[model samples]
Target chain A: MSYLQLSLYSETLRLETNVQVILAADPAASPCLLLLHGASDNDTIWARWTSIERYANRYGISVVMPGAHLSAFADMRRGPAYETFLMRELPEFLHRHLGLPTARELNLIAGLSMGGYGALRLGLRHPERFSAIGCFSSGNLLVATGFIPGTSDPYGWISLVMGEDINNPALAGNPDFDLFEILAALHADAPLPRVYMACGRDDFLLNCSRMTAERLAAHPALPFYYEESHGAHDWNFWDRYVKHFLDWYTDTEKTLTETTTD
Target chain B: MANIIFHSLSPALHTQRRLRVILPDSRRNDTNLPWLLLLHGAGADGSRWLRMTRAEYYAEAKGIALVLPDGDNGYYTDMRHGYKYYTYLSEDVEADVLRNFPSLSRDPQRRYVAGFEIGGFGALKYALDFPDHFRAAGSFAGGLDPQSLDPDYCVLTFGSYKQAWQAENDLFNRLRTALTDDTRLPDLYISRREQDYLYTVPDRDFASDNAMTSGHTIKVSRFDFNSADPWSFADRSLAWFLDRICPDRAQLFTPPAAADCPDDCHTDCSDDSLADCPTGKPTKE
Candidate 1:
């Protein structure tokens, strides 16, 4: 695997940001996987903590890991347009410079914790761009309260991105920013990407993952596979399950192709 | 990977400059990590190394920070007609990087410099000019002899061909002086492609001169590749830097153990159970 650390100027964000990419030995014609890191972490976590290089080499896939620091992959009201950067700017840059595949079948998105939320949100929002989405121990989905209460202000950090009025029709209409409203509005004809959701039984975000799973289960037309095992929301669980998710994605692709041909 | 850019007031250039850095993952907290001042060739900026080569992977594995500062097509020199890129790199950029990244080693032994093409020339010049700051230097297909370059470039870079040939600007003359001086000299490593017109003969002469000199150590390696499909000189140069700075850290690039020789596989073949190979071959039973 060939690793490249890039400092790109995002026109959308109007600031320079970092991205770490692991290219397969033969990146030409290789399917690309966008692996996102959680909050407070940068792109290097995948390289440092996990054997992602070995996995990319084995699977013949290109992995693009970009750091979206503290932003929940949302176009923040106070900060950068991270959602636009990831969905629009980043992919364009990758395609132009690295020859990353643009076809939906040749691309995959997966993340852990905050990144997991980003992956599912982005994938669901842009179904035409991704064939599969994997989320592990996801956070920032279906909070009982619109805000985490502690200080006098009920609407704190979450409100900064989702805005003051959580019940706004525009917010409810967009699945990427509002999962709860989007889940309720899911219809039979709406395009749905294949989803792979996993969380450790003991993870602090287990309830969030379960809630996401329950929401998805409500819509029979949406295709998703949810799994929970004995582990926590740590690197160990993520490392093991990330491998499984890749394998499952590969297998699922083959099965879909086989079924389509039949 | 951390991307940082800071403003630097360079007395040499008489202007504020931006220095870009690519830092290794913070998780690798072994110690104050070694650093490489990677200079870009002409027509590129600080970010070129990351875009063109697998430098980040190699740097991450070797646990070194990469300091990439824009050379601004100035040939990384104290240009007479233009900017003082050498001083900017050796002084301004270095100070800025060391100050911002306190985790990076201040020891000269842990600091190195390297570049490609004209940047390669810059690396050697930095080492020779500031021997107290850099422990080692590497040049990959660099323009070693500025005098041999296009007359216009030499004029723009050094004011004239005569100045370009002078000891201050000419690497050959500087290298000769280093050999004669009793001062601590940095280890030099140079690699050139055989087909490269600018560096092939100059690199050979530099290597030959160093070999004849008593105390200085200069290692030279050559490769042959078509211009269309050039070899990754960045990877080779980085490996050379790591080998010189920290030999133990150099082991990261070592080839994996032979497939037949698994962790449990015994080389002695003394025990019967271990003697029989997976291929059903009989051994010492």
Candidate 2:
């Protein structure tokens, strides 16, 4: 597998975002995984996992790890550029520079910690873009309403993104931010991508993961998979968890491969 | 002749959770039709069928209208946290589709449901769980029983075995019962690829032998394709199955063959040669 380190200016954020990208082969190969980094960290954070190479080689997919500062994947007041850069600019750059494929089999978004939140957020908002989504050790910012102080809003992060006051009832609790509710509604309308999420049993975020899992249990369409191991929020757990996600991703890719070109 | 119309719902949200409707097109607004709800597997949204498979074309060609619903990574379930996904897809989404699109036949025979991969499993589970809802059902390389799904994979899907099973065991047990019974399941078409890694030997075996022996009209087709490529698999099998079982959709069945194909399997390769690509080198043009 060949890996490339590239830096691109975020027209959305009006800043530069550095990314560590891995390509299984030249652009002739199928497009695979897109790895987005979590808060306070850059794309290199995923380098510590053994699963990165394993996934790149095993599935023959490329991984794009973007480095973004903390703020839980939010662009902060700097501009909603992080989401814009990821949803729009990143794909354009990859396709222009690396000759990646677009549409089905194009890209899957995944991340750990803050990156996980980003992955879920992106998947929820732009379901058409990604084939699959994996989240690791992150808060369910969508549903973290009461957990955060002085908020009656149902769509926690969504209100934040839309700049709506939490007290606004008309659209405040709108199901946009609550990813789990989005899944429930989406399952009724269409089938969603495979969801893979995990956290250590003792991790502080375990309850959040559990809450997400419990909600997923009701809908037959959403196959939200989860796991709790005896670990914490540190890299050791993420390393193992990421490997598990990669394995499933490879398996899903293999299962999805119904037709192969000559 | 478009039987179904595709609409973008939840546009206000950052993500595009689209809904495809199989209703009477403007030309056929006077006529009644049957509606089949189709769900896509993981890594995909509602557009997987309309955009990639051109299922809308098939729906237009046939009288049956197919609806594709978008489920984000939430796995088509209601969230434990607070999201009501289950209600949204089955109830709210259904209401929205019915209200927005022309009415299809209300007959159960016309009410079909199916999906691929995660969608596939969900389709089967939904049909079995609500046996009276759909007349025919299909799932391609679906993760059928989450609890029975491979532990390694299941753990990743739910984040833990306890949670995965706790949430999905009822469905698993119900499916297990259906596999053992002679009735109570829909006319099922379950399939998988020869090399799929997720729906392993156990899943295939269960779907083929047990799921069938229990009395449901279960037909499992093992294809010679890459299990990892959901789009290709769905485009072919979905078109084929929908045409056959839902003969009301005969027009969607365009013959597709896997031939002279490039090696479109792996994205990463140890071999540097472009010759390895099934599609050959991507043209700069």
Candidate 3:
């Protein structure tokens, strides 16, 4: 278990910010999981989970965590876009500080809550780079509360990202400016990536997750694997659900063998 | 000599996108070296990896040169309205690597592609779609199948199934089948935070199931850290993987050179230890 903390000048942000990372380098492993945290929390939150330790040993896998607290990992007009910072700036710092391989199959992203939302957004928004993704207890953006005064509204902390309100209304900088709309458009236009999600039944935001599930269900063209369990929005449920997802992903490889044989 | 010749994206490229090159140091500039092209996710540019991790330094030290290309919001793909990005990164970017950098290996084994977030998708997509381009690959927090797994995000981002149908058509099935079919796959490494906020149960399960059922050379890790600060996790995990697949590149093993150390600091400094160089040492003066 090694931890690397880095602070650097981001050409994207044009400011100096700090990035925290942790890794379990396993030489025997092939693909490395690069997990991103949700809004408000830091990297340590994931460290608190005992399953992480078990998964590391159980699968001979390694982990990479990047810190993006409060900031929505958005590229904005106000400050250096956090999205860019995490996607590009942060990786630079990690490559130098830690001895990680540079390849396509070696990286993956997963998150919870807001981070889960970001995961789905970022993953489909860019399908070529990531082969797979996992999102747990995500907030559905299509819902009305998706964008409030401070949470995602540009006027709040995210203002830097959305910029001054655009007159077009259609092109407003609001992060939630119809995220659902964008996804619908892309689904119609391009090849959306393979995505998976799990939510607890008792979770307060279960409706949001349910709505999300329903929207995709309408799309016969989309091929997504999903599951809903009896739990809540708390970390405990998220923890158990994430482990299950990992287990399923581990088992998905057998399909390839079957496909080849068939 | 291995050297990094950076090409600032011209105004057109910059406004349209950002691109940078990290070549081997002058000492490794002989035949073509192996090339590692990184694609960043979402709002990030080519320089993202440089900022997040000391990738350029490691690449320089490791003898593996890097090509960082901006993906913008295109997800490393060619979006609507003539966003020729998918071609830019896969075809044009490779062309540039072959022409300008000696670090690019003619052998596919020496070539690799990788990214974080959206870039993760780009890395995997490039490798999966273009299997001959690179021998191995990686994705950090990349997206898998959202249509079924994450409907809320799906509707929010894409609006309706009618609209998302085109982009999502057969994507999951293809990937599911592809992961299960190992004959044409690159070495893959997938990781996530145990308590991650995104890519919940379904996304994680999709990848995991593929790995478990398909016999794909897929690896998984749930680190103790979150995705926001995944530098350390990515560094350790990626380094471990690279060392195994592309071991000949010595620069990967070498650490970044001290920026503050002057030429004579190594000789004039009293501290003999590598960490004791004037620039390396902690000093009030």
> Candidate 1, which segments miss by more than 4 Å at Cα?
A25-28, A144-147, A150-156, A165-176, A185-187, A252-262, B1-285
The DockQ for candidate 2, computed on C-alphas, is: 0.02
TM-score of each: 0.47, 0.47, 0.42
Choose the strongest candidate by DockQ.
2
Q: Which has the greatest lDDT?
A: 1
Q: Give the TM-score (vs. native) of candidate 2.
A: 0.47
The share of true interface contacts that also appear in candidate 1 amounts to 0.00
Worst 10 residues of 3 chain A by lDDT: A253-262
Cα error, candidate 1, residue A135 (Å): 0.4
Docking class of 1: incorrect
lDDT of 2 by residue, A1-262 (tens): 7878675546665443467777887554665677766543555667654457655765677778876544345543212346767777878888887887667556678888667877887786777787788988874655543345355534433333444444542332446455665665563565367788888887777777777767666667765777777888777777666667877766663432212111
Q: Ten-residue segment with the worst summed lDDT in candidate 1 chain B?
A: B268-277
Clashes of each: 0, 78, 195
Candidate 2 wrong stretches, greater than 4 Å: A1-153, A156-262, B1-17, B22-30, B80-83, B145-159, B167-172, B197-204, B208-214, B227-229, B248-285
Clashing pairs in 1: none
* DockQ of each candidate relative to the true complex: 0.01, 0.02, 0.01
- Write candidate 2's Cα lDDT for B1-285 as tens digits: 443434333322222234656553633654456767888765455755666776776666655677777664445665432234555677766666667655666667767888877787667767876777778888776765566555544543454556765634345566666678655667877656655553355543555455544666666554446545557777666766766675643455433233433445653322212233455432110
